[model samples]
Target: MKSNQFKIVIDDTREILKWISHISKWFFPLILAKNIIQATLPYIHILFGYLILDGIIAKDSSSDIMKNLYWMIGLNLGLGLLHSFLTRLLNVKTEYIHHATKAEIARKAQTLDYEELEKKESLDLLRRAEEGINSNGGIPSFCNTIGSLITHAITIVYSILLLSGLFIAAPKENATVLERVFNSPLPTLLFFILFASALFLNFKISEQLNKRSYAFFEENVDTNRILNYFGGVSNNYNFGKDIRIYGMADMIQEEMNQKNDAIITMMRSLGITYGRYSALIEIVNQFVIFSVYIFVGIKAILGLVSIGSILKYVGALIRFIGAVSSITIFYTQLDLQRQYLNNYSLFLNLENKKYQGTLPIEKRDDNEYELEFRNVSFRYPNSPDTVLDRISFKLKVGNKMAIVGRNGAGKTTFIKLLCRLYDPTEGEILLNGINIKKYDYKEYLQIFSVVFQDFKLFSFDIGQNVAASIDVNEEKVWKALEQSGISERVKKMDRGIYTNIYQNEENGIEISGGEAQKIAISRALYRDAPIVILDEPTSALDPMAEYEIYARFDHMVSQKTSIYISHRMSSCRFCDHILVFDKGRIAQVGNHTTLMKDEKGLYHTLWTKQAKYYN
Candidate 1:
C-alpha cells in the first residue's frame, strides 16, 4: 500500500514535469538566450567603465586610449538595446505559457471521475495541487527559476574568467597584494560559511512555511464541508423552521468561529517564526558584506592595485555571489513545488473501482436481454457490514417494477448495483446471461436514466438544465418542462426557457423545491432512456402536483421499463409489480393489489399506516 502510494506521488511529479517541458520547449530557449545576454551585458558594462576610467586617469595621451573609448561607447549602447528587447519578449512569452499550462491542469481536473473526487484524502491532495502548483504565481516562479539558474551559471563562469585575468595582468613585484588576499583565507572562508548558513536557514524556514500553508489549505476542505451541510439544512424549509425554533443558529455560528480561530492562530505563529529567521539572516548578510569591503579597500589604497581594477573586481565578486544565492533559492522553490505536484499526481492516479472494465454492460444487445442478480452481495468500501446480502432477482425486458423499502433496507443500494455505480462483492450481475463487466461502462450508463432522491439543480438556463448541455432545442425543452408539470410556471417567467434560474447572481430567479424537482424530471425525460429509475420523485410535491406529474410520466414512458421507489403506498398503486425490501432481503414481491391483501407483508403494514392520511 505504501509503495503504491509512493508510485502515485511519482506519477504526479512526472505529469508536472511534462507540463513544464511543453512550456519550456517553446519559450525556454528564448528565456535562456535572454538571461545569457542579460548576464554578459553587466560584465561588458563593468569592462567599459574600467576602460573609460583608464583613459581619463592617463590624461588621454595614448592613441590606443581614444580608440578604446569609442569601442566602450558602442558596446554600452548595443548592450542596453539588446537587454531591453529581450526582457520584454521574455515577460510576454512567460505569461502566455503560464496561462496555457494552468488551463491544461484545470481540464485534467475536470475529467477526473466524480466518485474518486468525493474522497476526503483525494480532495486534500487536489487542494495542495491547486494551492502549490496551480496558483497565480507558481508557474511564473518556476519558469523564472529555470531562467535565473541558467543565467547565473554563465555569470559565475564569466566572473571566474575576469578574476583569472586580473591575477595575470598585475606586475610581478605587486604579487604580494594577491598573496595577502588569498593567504589570510579567514575572510573568504568566513564569508562563504556565513552565506551558506543563511541560505540553509532560509530554505528550512521556507519549508516550514510551505507545510503550514498546505495544512491551512487542507483545513479549508473541512471548513467547506461544514459550511455546505449548514447551508443545505438552513435552506431546507422543513429543517429551517425547526432549527430556528430550537435556536441552533448560535451553535452553528460557534462551530464556524472556532474553526476560523484555529486557522488564524496557526498562520499567526508561522508568520512570527518566519519573521525572526528572516531578520537574523539579513543581519548576518550585512556583516559578510562589510568584511569583504574593508579587506579590498585597504589593499587598493596602499598602491597594490589600481582604483579601476578594485572597482571591476569588487563589482564582479558581488554579481557572482548574488547569482549563486539566486540559484540556490530557485532550486529550493522547485523542490517545494515538486512536493505539491506529487500530491496532485497521487490523486489523479487513484484507481476508480467503478471504471475498472474495458466496456460497460449496457452496450451489448446481442440477444433478447434480461437483467439478473445471482446471489449478489455488497458492502461499501472500508466497511465490514454488508449493505446487500445474498440477494437474487431477475427482471425481463419491458417489465415495470417498483421497489418498496423502509429506510436503510438496501433499496437504493440495489438500484446503484443495477447502474454499476458499484459492483456486487459476492456474486454476478448479468445482462443477457453475460457478466455486466464485459460491456462498456459508458454504454451501460446510457441504458438507465435515474432521478436520485437528492438531485442537483444547475445554475443554468432552463433549457441547459433539462438538456445537460447548451445544444438542446427550445421546443423539446418546453415539451419536457410541460411533461414534468413545470411548463406553466416557466412560461409565466420573464425570460421563459432562457432565464437563468439561480438566485445567487443578478438577473437570476430562485426556484422552489418542487420546481427544481420538475426540472430534474425533465432532464431524465429528455434522455429518452429505456430504463427509468425514480427515487422519491414526489417527496417534495403536494398531492395534486404529485398526481399531475405521475399522470404525465406514465403517459410519456408507457413503453419504457420503469422502477419507482417511494415510501408513499398510494404512489405505487399503478405499478405493475412491487418488490418490498426488509433488512437487505426481499420480504414480499407481487402486484400492488396482491401485496395489499397479504396480512403478514411489510408493504401491507406500510400501506395501512399511510392509508389513514388519504382517508
Candidate 2:
C-alpha cells in the first residue's frame, strides 16, 4: 500500500513538472537561480553585519570595515536586480501555464468519445477537476510552493553550516557552570531535538487544516456548480427574456444569497480553526527564540564569543527553527496540491474507447463514395432501450435521398451512427466495402458535411464561420453564401462577409433565426464534402424560407450524395428515393409515387395526413 502511494506521488510530481516544463522549458532552471539568490541574500546580510560589528569592537582598521561593507552592498544590488528580472519573467510564464491548462482541458473534452461525454459521470468528474484546480490555484501555485520549499531548505542548510563552529568550540577552563552548560554540545543536541519536535507538530497541524480544506471543496462541488449556473444565467442575454417574463430575478437572488451564506459560514469555521493552530505555532516559535537568546547570551557573558557572534548565532538559530517549521508547512501544502491535482490527472487520463484507426481514407476524383449500414444496431451508453435496431440500408452514390419520419422515429439516430458520432452496438457500417471504423477517425469524417438540427455558429466573422478556420478564402465564402441564398442579405451589411455573428463584440450584428440557418447552410456548402446531410437545419426558418433552401439545395449539393431529413412530406417529393422510418425500423422505402399507390402504408398515411392539413 505504501509503495503504491509512493508511486502515485511520484507520478503526480512528474505530471506537475511536465506541465511546468511544457509551458516554459526554462522555468525550473531560472526558478532555481531565483531561489538561490533569495536564500543567500539574508545570510549574506547576517554574516556581513557580524563582520562589521566585530571589526568596530576589536578596533580593526577603517579600510577593512569599509571594504567588507562595500562588497556586501554591491553583491546585494547586483543579485537583487537579477532576481527581480527572473521573477517578472517567471510570473508571465506562470500565467501562461494557468490559462493553457484551461485550454488543454477544453481540448481534452472535444477529443473525448461522444458517448463518454454524454454521461453525467463525465460532467461531475469535470466539475470536481475544475474545483481542484481553482482551490489549488492550478499548476502555478504548485510550482510556487515547491520553489518556496526549496528556498526554506536551502536557508536551513546554510544556517546549519554557519552555526557548526559555535557548537564545536570548547568553553574556557575558568567558565561558570551555567556558561559551561550553554557552551557544551548538549545545548546543540537540545536545539536539534527541539527543532525536530516543532516540525512534527507543525506537520500534524497542517495536515488537519489541509484535510478540512479538501473536504469543504469536495462537499460543495455540486453547490458550487449550481451557484456558477445561476451566476452565469443572470448575465446571459439568451436567458434575459425568460428571466424578465417569469420574474426569476428575486428567486435567483435568493438562491445565490443562500449559497453564499453557506460558504461564508464554512469559511468562518475554517478560519477559527486556523487561528487556534496559528496561536499554538507562535507559542512554540517564541519558546525556541527564548532558548536561543539564553544559550548565545551566556557564551557572550563568559567572553567565549564576541557580541557580534552572539547576534549572529541568535539570528541563525531563530531563522533555522523558522525554516524547519516552514518546511513542514510547505511539505503539507505539496500534499494538499497533490490531492487536488489527482482530479485533473484522472480527468486527463480518461480513455477514449473508440478506436482511432491509422489507415488513410481513399480519395476519389469522381466523388462517388458509397455508404452501407449492414445490420447495425445501437443503444446509447447505459440505456436499456435500443434507438436503432438491426436497421440496414445503402446510400446510393451521388443520389439525393430523403428520410421522412415522425418524432422519435430514429431518423437522427441513424444520422448519428452514419456520422460515426457513436459506434454501433452490433454489426458495423461500411464505407465503399471496408468497415468505416477501419479508416482514420478524422479522415473518415472529412468525407461528409452535415448540418444538424441544432447546429451552432460562433461569434466570429461570417467569412471565418464559413471557412471554419482563421485562413478564410473570401471568394469561396461569398460563393457559398450566394448558393445558400444569404448573399444579398450579407452584401447589405457595412462589412459584408467580415460582419461578426451575434452581439458578442463591438459592432457585431444579431442575425435572425432564418439568417443564422442560411449561414449554417453556407458553412456546409463551403466544406463541399463528397456527401451532404441536412438534418432539418431549416426548422428555425419559415415555410417559404425552408422551401427556398430545399429548392436551391440540388444546385447547392451539385453532384454530391445528399441525405435530407425533414418532417414536411411535400418537400421530399423532389427526391428520387425516400425512406420512411417507424419505431426504429425502416417500415417503407420507395419513391413518392410508388409509396403513395399503397393506401394503407405508413408513408401513404403520413403523406395523406400532411396533404389534408395543407388543404
Candidate 3:
C-alpha cells in the first residue's frame, strides 16, 4: 500500500510538472512565488508580534520599538501587494492552461479515426476525458492542489523553525529532575512523535474522504451523461414540438427525476461519511493542541522559558499542526485529481490504428482520379455480421453513377468505404492504380465531396456553413447556394448569406428541412472536388424537387465524377451507369435502359414499385 501510494504521488507530480512546463514556462515560477509569499505572510506577522512582546519585556528603547513597528508594517504591506500581483498572474495563467487543455482534448477528438469515434470503448473514454475537463476542473484542480501542498509545506517549515527553541532551550541547574527532563531535547523528540501520530490519524481520515469523493465522481459519469442528454433535449428547440405533441414531458421528467434522486442519495451518503471522518480529524487536532499547551506550560513553570517564548511556542505549534493536517488533506485531494488526469492522458494516448500514409497525392488538373474497390469487404468493430461483403466496383474519371437499393442494402456502407472512412476489412481500395492507403490520408480525402444522408450544419452564418470555413469566398458561396437552389431564400433573409442558421443567436432563424438539405448540398458543391457524392441528399425534398436538384447538380458536375444515391427512381434515369445493391453485395450493374429490361432484377423491381407511387 505504501509503495503504491508513493508511486501515484511520483507519477502525478511528474504529470503536473509536464503540463506546467508545456502550458506556460512561467506558471511554476509564479505559483512557487505566490505560495511562498502566502505561506510566509502569516508567519511574518506572528514573528513580529513575538518580537514586540519580547522587546517590551527586555525594556528596549522606545525609538527602537517604534522602528521595529514601522518595519513590520512596511514589510507586510509590500508582501501583501506582491502576493496579490502574483496571484492575479497565476489566475490568468490558470485560465489559459484550462482553455489550452480543453482545446487539446478537442483537437485529439477531432483527429481520431472515424472508426474509433464509433467504437463504444473510444466513446466512453472520450466522455470520461471531456467530463474531467468540463465538470471536474481538470488541470486547474491540479494547479490548485499543487499550490495547497506548497503553501502548507512552507507553513510547516516556518512553524517548526519558530518553535525550535521550545525543545532546544537548556534546563536551568536549579530545576527539579522532572522539569529538567521536560526541558531537555528528549521532550522535543517526544513532542515530534506525538505530532507524527496526530498527522498519521489525519492522513488516514483524509485518504478515506478522498476515496469516497473519487468513487462518487466515477459513479456519476454515466448518470451525468444520461441526465445531460435529457437536459439537452429539454432545452433544444428542435425537440420542443415532439415533446409537446407526444406528451413526452412527463416521461423525460420522470427519467431525469430518477437519475437526480440516485445522485442526491449518493451525495447525502457521502456527506454523512465525510462528516464522521472530519470529526475524527478535528478530535486529533485538538488533542495535539492540548499536548502542545501542556508541554510549553510545564517549561514556563520551570522558569526555563520566558512568557513571550511560551506564547511563541504555542502559536507556532498550533500553526504547525494545522499545516501538517492541511498537507495530508491536500495530498489526498491531489491524488484524486491525478486519477482524473490519468483518464485524460489515457484518451490523448489512444492510438489511431488506421494507417495514415505519408505519400502525397499527385496534384492533377484533369480531375482524373480513378477509384476501385477490388473484392472489398468490411464488418463493424465487434459485430459478427459483415456490413459490406466482397463489394467489387470501379469508377472512371467523370463518370456519372447511380447507386440504388432499399434500406440496409449496403449502399451507405459502400459510400463509406469509397470515402475511406473505414478501410476494408479484406481486400483493398485503389486510387488511380495505386492502393488508396499509400496516399496521404488527408490528401486522399480531398478527392471527393460527400453529402451524406444524415448531414449536419452548425449554427454558423449561412456563408460559413455553406463554405464550411470561416474565410469564405463570397463569389463561390453564392454560386454554390444558387446551384443548390437556396440562393433566393438566403437573399430574402435580413443578413443574406451572413444570417445564422438556427436560433443560436438572437438574429438567427430556423430553416426548413428542405432548406437545410439545400445548404448541405451547397456545402458539398463549395468543395468542387473531382468526385461528388449525394447520399439520400434529397430525402427531405418532394420527388419533383429532388429531381430538380439532381438535374441541376448533374449539370453542375457534368465534367466531374458524380455518385447519386436516392430512393426516387426518377433521379437515376439521367445517370449514365447504375449499380444495384442487395444484402451486402452488388446484385446488378448496368444502365437505366439495360437494367429496366430485366424485370426480375432488383433494380427493375424497385424502380417499378417506386414508379407506381409517383404515377
Candidate that scores best on lDDT: 3
Give the per-residue lDDT digits (tens) of candidate 3, residues 226-246.
999999999998999999999
What lDDT is obtained when candidate 1 is compared to the true structure?
0.73
lDDT score, candidate 3: 0.87
- Over 290-358, each residue of candidate 2 has an lDDT whose tens digit, in order, gives 988877787787777888888788878888888888987887788889888778777877889988788
Q: What's the TM for model 3?
A: 0.97
Cα error, residue 72 of model 2, in Å, equals: 1.4
Query: Residue 202 lDDT in model 1?
Result: 54
Better of 1 and 2 by lDDT: 2
Ranking by TM-score: 3, 2, 1
Task: Tell how far residue 244 is off in model 3, in angstroms.
Answer: 0.5
Candidate 1: misplaced stretches above 4 Å?
1-15, 21-45, 59-115, 134-136, 166-169, 172-253, 351-369, 503-506, 613-615
- Between candidates 1 and 3, name the one with more favorable TM-score: 3
Candidate 1 RMSD computed on C-alpha atoms after optimal superposition onto the true structure:
5.0
TM-score of each: 0.82, 0.94, 0.97
User: Judged by TM-score, which candidate is best?
Assistant: 3
Please report, in order, the local distance difference test score of every candidate based on alpha carbons: 0.73, 0.86, 0.87
TM-score of structure candidate 1: 0.82
Tell me each candidate's RMSD, in Å, in order. 5.0, 2.3, 1.7
